[model samples]
Structures are given as C-alpha cells and as structure tokens.
Target: MSAARGPDVYVGLMSGTSTDGISAAAARFLPDGDVLGVELLGFVQQPYDASQRARLLAAMESGSARDYCMLGADLGGWLADAAAALLAESGVARADVRAVCSHGQTLWHEPGHSTWQAGESAVIAERLGVDVVSDFRVRDVAAGGQGAPLVPIADALLFAAPEHWRALQNLGGIGNVTVVPPSRGAVDPTAGVRAFDTGPGVAVIDAVARRVRPQLPYDVDGQLARAGTPVAAVVDALLAEPYFAAPPPKSTGRELFSAAYTARLIDDCRAARPTATDEDLVATAVSLTARSVADAYRRFLPEPVREVLLSGGGARNPVLVESIARELAARADAPAVRAFDAVFFDGEAKEAVAFALLGFLHVERRPGNVPGATGARGPRVLGKLTPAG
Candidate 1:
C-alpha cells in the first residue's frame, strides 16, 4: 500500500482496561477539503470468555515476561478474528481495508514513565494480510507526555461541538476526559483541548461487584448501585487521594486503580459504615467515579463546557450517568451530560473509531498526538507499521 494512495477503509480494535473484550469498528473516511468525514460501516464487540478475562486480569496484576510473550501472540490472533468479524458484518472486503489499527490491550500504563500495549502487529498483519498499526502510545510517552487520552485529536476533528466546548468523557476501566473547543472556533481548534484520567471509572465498581457476588461480572446496568445508597464518607475519603488533586495531561490505569486498590476501597467503605451492605459498597464505587469526574473538570478544565458526551461501557449504566449529572449540576453552569451515541454514533464504538482515525493519520503522514492534551513536547505521528506478508 503506497502512502500516496491514501486508503480510506480501515479497522480499529480496542481492548480497554476493563479487560472485558475487544471492540472493533470498520469505517470509511472521506476527505473533504480540510475536514475528514467518517462513515461507520459497522461495529462489533467480541467479549473475552471467562478464561480469557481471567488470564488478562491476572496478566495485568502479576504476569511474568513469558506470560506476556505468549499473551501478546494469542491476543493478536483474537484481535484479528474481531477485525474479520467486523468486516463480515460491515460487508467490507479484507482487500479493501487499507490498514488495521489496534490499540492492543494495555497491560501496564504509567504516564510519563513507560507504557506497554500487547498484541503482535506482525501476527495481525500475517493473519489479516494488511498493513498493521500498533503501539500508538509509546511515541507520545517518549516525547515526555502522559501517552494517554490520545483521543482528543479525534474528538476535535470528528466530535467537536458546533459552537461551544465539549467534554468527551470515556468510562472504560479507567475514566478519562477530553475537553475540546468547538470545530468552528475562531482560534486553533485543538489549542484548547485538554485531557487527563479522572481517577476510577467502573474498575472499582466492577471489582467490588465481582467480589461481593462471585457470579457477577459487573454491576449490570448499575442495578446493585441503584439498590443501595452511596456511603458519603467513603466517597469523600477516596476523593481526597492525591490523584484527584493532581492536574491534567496525566494518565492512569489498572496500575493505580488495581484490584488491590479496590480491595482497600471496599474495606474503607465497610469501616465508614459497619452496617454497609454489598450494594452500598457498589454504590460508593459509582459515586467515586461520578465525583472524581466532576472534580477534575473544576480543577483542570480551562474553559466552561457546554456539553459532556459520555462514552464507553460506563455510559450504558443509568445510575452512573445520573450520578455524574447530579455531581455536575452542583456547578451553576453545569454542562449537559448525555450519551455519545445520542449525539453521534454508538458510544461503545467511539474509542475504536478514534483509533481508526489515528491509524488514518499515520497512513497520511499526519501527526496524531495533541501537545496540549498529552503534554508532549510537540506533535508526533504515532504507531509502528508492519506490512502484510
């Protein structure tokens, strides 16, 4: 595939910190002057079975080098299968896709230090017979950035509001927010973009739910949380952690909000209220996610946001969404919080599509990272490519 050809059809794969499954999106991009238009051909989410989820979670917690080596190869095949499934669903031919952009599962991410995402690009290229783009974050991290919240560029180009600043909050295993200036703004569209991790998302809540009820994978639409009241004291204490106070251009993952951390949070919840039930613990975790997001906006957002577009798995949870809305309501000019799908395409497809955009940029020889968002020294084209055999 020559760079001059500029392939428009691409596939994006993302396995978030939630360690649940792979989200894949097949899209076609049309370049219209300065703006690029995206058509979502199809989207599919292939969930990891119980065994796959267990291995992934255990790898995140304490996998050895050999474990990572094998997991990376296995994950690539799984990712390839997902891409094939997406193409089959979208009715797109493999020969038509320009490249496959895989965010790969993030086994460990430590902002400003080092980040590692597994899934062998060679394996993907070999299996798919297409150029592969993987390891998109390391380049930004090498430039002294958080190497996270890389979706701001995509938000600015694809999802920015018409007139006001928009906050794109992703609720994966870890919560991250991107505040983007309007696409029609007078100044540089990306100049005002700022992003950072907002403490925990559903990671803690899911962990709590699974611990309390071994049979449950997650809160299941926040049912557990809605059934019980949040422990105010526990939420307050958790917010007081240094991470919430830390400023933007930062990132975090299971590294900070690990299973061990979740265990501690549950203990604190019980200690705060000896009579606290499992439902209460789950509610407290939800409250922490909601409060932490609102707090981050207050501390780091440079401009007032007119809207907050919620995405990822957490967006599907009404109790979590309602909690976020209530927390933001405390502000006199709180932004309207709504599902990303309501305003754009499917919420679950946002991240996958964002990665697809990144891959598009890579193929076009355009820089992918936004300096303001990632705190990188300057713009840099991310991802390493592996040509099809």
Candidate 2:
C-alpha cells in the first residue's frame, strides 16, 4: 500500500443500522492518527419515503442485485444532499473539505466472506464535488477478518483510559460493546485496551417493534417495553440464538436477525398466547438486547469492568439502559458500569465523529483497526479515497 498525504479537513458521514438519518461530522488530523479537532458540525435525517424504505428492506431480506444498484444511486444522492445541507448550515464550502468518509448504509455484513454497504463513492463525489473514502469494510474482510467491529480501533485510541477498564457499548440496531481494560491490573489500575461487539443491540427490538406495531417506527425510548413485564418464554427463545453462543471473532447484521427471524419469534409468542399485546412483545425484545450484552460480558470478557460507556441511538432508551445496568450488577465480581460521561453531548452525532477520526487515520496512512477487536490478522489501512474529479 502507498502512504497518503494528510488532508486538512475531512468529513465523515454515517448512516447506522437504525436507518434513521445521515449524521455528518468534521475532523482535522495530526500525523499520529489522533483527531486534532472533531465537531458534529451539522445533521439531517433524510427519511426514506414508504416506497424507498420498503424497497431497501426487501433488498436486505432478499439478495436482489438490481435493488442494490438502484438503492446505491438513490442513497448516494441522499448523501450528497446531506453533505451539501451540512456545509450550507455551517457556512463551510464544498471546496473546503479535503475528503468525505462515508460509512454508508450497511445492507449486509458477513464476517470472513463478504459484506456490502451501497452508496456509490463516485456518485457521492460527482454530486457533492468532493473526494470520498468509502467501502471501509471490504479490505478488512479480504484480510480474513470479521470486519464488523471496526470502531473499536477508534475507541482504543481516542477513548481508552490509562487506569480504568472501560467497555464502550453501542446499542444501535445491533448491540456491540468494546471492552477497553484498565491500563494495568484491576487493582493495580493499569492495563491496555481491547474491544469487540457484544452482539444484538437494537436489532431485535426494532424488528419486533416493526412487526408488533406497524403503526410505530420504534418503541420510542422503550416506552412500550416499560409498560409491560419481560416474557420468560420469549427471553429463553432469544437466548438460544446461535450468535449468542458463538465465540469472539464473529460479526452479524440484518442477515442474521431479519424480519424472518423476528416473525418466527412473534409466531412463537403468539402460539404460546394468542392475545399478547404489542407492549408484551416490545418488552421481550428489550430484554433480548440487554440479556445478550450482559451474557457476552459474563461469558467471554469477564474482566472487572469499571465503566460501560454507551453510544448509538439505543442509549437514549431508559428501559434498555436500566436493564443493562441491572444485568451487570448481578455478576458476583463485576465492577461499576455506567453510561458514557459525555452521553448526551451529541447522541445523534457520535458515530459520525468516530468515522471522522477513522478518515483522519486513513488520510495519515495509519492502521485504524484493532486486531483483538475486529479479529483481523493485523492492523491495516481502511477506506478507499476517490479524488474530486
């Protein structure tokens, strides 16, 4: 690989699993891959119209190549508008941005084999009149890795504590936690950082919500869940999911916990009780996210965790947050686990900030992935840059 000359201002655009909107952040870099300055300059949620969302969902549920191409172009246009809007709002010009690092919208993410997130870089470049660095996961997948927990590298470098073992938990459409151990021993107060995805964050919840109450886009802060009690049968069935039992070095997305899987759960719940309400289903789904996360920590990474720093859209839900805290508290030797100190600083824009940091690293020709986290063979350069042609 060739080294890259650093760019002064890089914009990172992210559309997480929630499919809620586009988040954009601006970041400048130093040679060491540290972000000199990162600001969530602006944000815009370009909602997918009913037809567009249905088409996207269908493509995700089925392997439709035509849908992939069509959605890619549509998404690229949406991204261009998002970038333009942000720049206009912030009074920054397109020419001022050195590059745009878009995480894009992940459609399918399979571990060692393949992962696809559509939104053509060339289209983004042409529409926005700026360079783009996208398809961020392919190189890592090619290197024989899970290629899913890419953000752990950013977490270790930008957020790791010297004297505390931290777990950065992101509860998006799918829940993933990065365990950054104390700089040392638990008692000695020093250990290096390590992180990975804990699995099944908001994926199950959102799926169940869409099915149980088509009238609602989500449970809305888990309000529906908070109104009902957890269902033991549903919880047990969810716990039996193969992904939960899988060891580390694994990654999954809509491919595993899709509408089909959610439908099955709904069927089972209905068979057991034909008159269950949406609240009951939402509560059960909430438990799935919380339990899976707690189980991963207890089963795989049992180190004494000092804090559970959270990000992503799921962190805003009071019901889910309380469940996670309660689960961690049950362990015999668990340390204190709290939400991110800067939790509300900008809930909508943190992932964009993360990608901004990644783009900075890419521009500096630095390895931005953690081997222990993403299960890669080793650190490698991420993102492919397209010049502003």
Candidate 3:
C-alpha cells in the first residue's frame, strides 16, 4: 500500500487499564528514513463520569454478553468525543487528520490466549469522519506472544535517551516498563528493548482508598500512604506471588488483581497486624508496586538502566514516586528516577501519543509491535482500519 497521502496529523485515543478516563492526543509525524519523529499538537483528557465508570468496572469484573456488546459501542462514542475535543483544542481541522488511532478500553486481557479491547472502530470512524485503527493486541496474542506492553515500539523509536539505556515505566492501573537503548548512533532502535507488566500500579492502592473512604476515588496526593507506614510483611507476602518471578513475555490484568483480590489483601494485612490502619493498608499496596518494579529490574532487565522515566496516573502520586526511587536506591547501579514530563511531554499523554504513532504505522503498512518487547514471533502490523464513509 502507498503511504497515506494527507497532512501528517493524527489523533490517538487511549483508555488504559486504570479506566480513569480517555486521553486524546493530536500529533504530527515527520518520517526520517526509517525513523519517525513526532510533535505533540494538543492533548485532552476526558474523564468518565461516575455512572460510566461504574458500568465499565462492572463489565471488567463480570458483565454479560449484552453488557460487553453495548459497552463497546458506548466506549467508541466516548473515544470519538475525546478525539473531537482534542482536535478542537489543537485547532486542527478534521479533514487534515490522516487517521484516529484508539487503544480502546481493554476489558479482558489474558495474555497468549485471548485479548479483547472494547470500542468499535466503526463508531469512531463514523463519529470522527476519519479513518480509525483499533484493536492492536489481537495480532500479537495470535502469534503466541503476550499481547501487552505494546507502547515499547514507540519508546524505542521516539523516547529513547540520548546516550544510555532508559526505562519507560508506566504507572497506569498496572505497572509496565519498557527499557529502550539510546537513540543515538546507527544502532538498531528496537534491538535491545524489553518490556512487561511489573504488577499492580495504583489499582490496589486506589481500591483501598475507596474502601477506606467511599467518596474517595483515589488516595489523592498520596497523603494517606505518606501518613502511614507500610506493612512490610504484607508487602513481602504479596510480592511472593509467582507472577513477579515469571520471566518476561508475560502480562496480567484484573484477572489476577481484582476487587476480590484487594479484599483478600486487606484481610491479609489485618491478619498480619490486627491494628493495621486503612492508611497502612494503602501504604502496603504502594510498597508492593514499588518493590515489584525494582524486583523486575533486577531479575529481568538485560542491560543496566541509566535512568527510569515514569508516566501515567501513578506518576502523579508523590509517595508512589518516592517509594519507587527509594526501592531502586538500594541497588548499586541504581538509575535516576523522574517523571516523564520532566524530560518530555505530559506523562498522562504518553500512551495516547503512542497509539497515534501506531496508527501512523498502520496507515503506512509498517510493523508496529517490537518483537523484543512483546515477545511476538515477529513484527506485525497491528490494528484493523475502519474508513470513514
């Protein structure tokens, strides 16, 4: 297929595992030989209302076929709204947008077996009046790989550090890391990239926060965790789970750390220390996220990282960030940890921007998944296109 002929502008829509909201980014790509360069035009975050979030959580936990079917369409409309808002904010014309790429809300992700991302491309296409690319993980899973950490390709190509190995740790609902070699020199960008889910990001902490105070959606500013000490025993026992020890080319989701799991975690904390306060439980969850990330680095990373750039909702939590930095500080080769925004664009917009690049690749018929990161047998062009009528 010929390269897409139009303005280089593309919009990326993302609703991550956190189910917090839709993050939409409009960016312009400049292709330099085999490498692609991108400039962020604008970004918009459209949060799901209480009812919408509740419905989505229900679908994720245990929804009927009817729920899934309806939710997919509804989500598409929401994604379209996000895209429209982004374009409006960016002052980019609808016709100039070459395509809209969406990493639709992932409802079920059982790596190597099956994965489902709910959000109808047709709906996005019709609503946005632009070509839409959606469902990016199915191809990788079908190729006998963990269909996850798909943004590593973007990391390798677009976000690599100048002279050393860098780890792009996304603290979304689940923590996943993509370690990319430096972009300088004639090195193959994707050659050294490795990525996988470290474990729960802020999911457990958020669950505990809600349990502690019904109205609280999350432990805002990490005050709860900072005020309380982590139950070290609870953190250690939780990390002992087999997933943390498993080799890469692996992934996980709510299937393992569901609401029920959070409840059990609270029970474990209480059992370990009957006087454990709600803040302590929240602190333990934070510790679990921090320790698991450090453990993954020690056990799996192929190269010593020079820096770790954090992105996503968890990055906003100071206590979580400090915990991760502290966890890594003990290592002799500890790398500097900092928010992604300090070095690049807003951390919240990283995933959405990644999907925009993926969409650009799909339109160009180029492989998007990095074999090293996703453990796919080989590279493959991901997502299905839905042309606007």
| Pairs that collide, model 1 | none
Minimal lDDT window, size 10, model 2: 184-193
Question: Per-residue CA lDDT of candidate 1, range 150-265, in tens?
Answer: 99888877888777889999999999998887676335657778888898888888999999998988999889999988999878888888888987778888888998889888
Weakest ten-residue segment in model 3 by summed lDDT? 29-38
lDDT at position 226, candidate 2: 91
Count of residue pairs whose backbone atoms collide, per candidate? 0, 10, 0
RMSD of each: 2.2, 4.2, 2.3
Clashing pairs in 3: none
lDDT of 1: 0.90
lDDT ranking, high to low: 3, 1, 2
Which of candidates 2 and 3 reaches a greater lDDT?
A: 3
TM-score for predicted model 3 compared with the true structure: 0.97
* Candidate 2 lDDT tens digits, 19-44: 76778776554433322324445555
Error of 2 at 251 (Å): 0.7
Global lDDT for candidate 2?
0.75
In model 1, what lDDT does residue 35 have? 53
